[model samples]
Target: MNEVKASMAGSVWKIVAKEGEQVKSGEDVAILESMKMEIPIPSEADGTVKELKVAEGDFVNEGDVIAIIE
Candidate 1:
């Protein structure tokens, strides 16, 4: 299993990948809102989304695990 981590602190804006969805490396899985900007969170590896650790509007810090990929 691989963990997808947040690159910066922000509120989750949207989740683009769903559980059991297959994702490629560098694919945007979620979007984060911070400082009036939208930051896209990308997957680090090619795999299926195993779990989402957060939901829309949830706050997250840098390095926080956002999703589990396998």
Candidate 2:
């Protein structure tokens, strides 16, 4: 299993990958809004998205797990 972690502290702007969706390494799984900038959170592993830990409009800190891939 691999965990996709948030790169920065921000509110979740969008979730690009859904549960059970296939994803490749470096693919954007979610986008976060912080300091008026949009930051895309990428998956570090290639696999199916097993779960999403945060929802759109939810705030998360850096290093927070965004999703699980396996």
Candidate 3:
């Protein structure tokens, strides 16, 4: 399993995938809002989305695991 982590402190703006969903590397998995900017979080590897550690509007810190892929 691989952990998809947040790159910086931000609020989750959109969840582009859900549990059990298959994601490819470089595909946007979620969108985050930080410093008035919208950043897309991409999948680190091609795998099924095993879990989401945060939700929309949730605040996350840098290096925090945002999702698990397996």
Per-prediction CA RMSD (Å): 0.5, 0.4, 0.6
RMSD of 1: 0.5
Which stretches of model 1 miss by more than 4 angstroms?
none
Candidate 2 structure quality by residue, lDDT tens digits, 21-64 = 99999999999999999999999989999999999999999999
The alpha-carbon lDDT assigned to residue 70 of candidate 3 equals 96
Clash pairs of candidate 2? none
Report the C-alpha lDDT of model 1 over 1-70, residue by residue, as the tens digit.
9999999999999999999999999999999999999999999999999999999999999999999999
User: In model 3, which runs have C-alpha deviations exceeding 4 angstroms?
Assistant: none
For candidate 1, what is the lDDT? 0.97
> Residue 63 error for model 3, in Å?
0.4
- By TM-score rank, best first, the candidates go 2, 1, 3
Worst 10 residues of 1 by lDDT: 1-10
What is the TM-score of each predicted model, taking all chains together?
Answer: 0.98, 0.98, 0.96
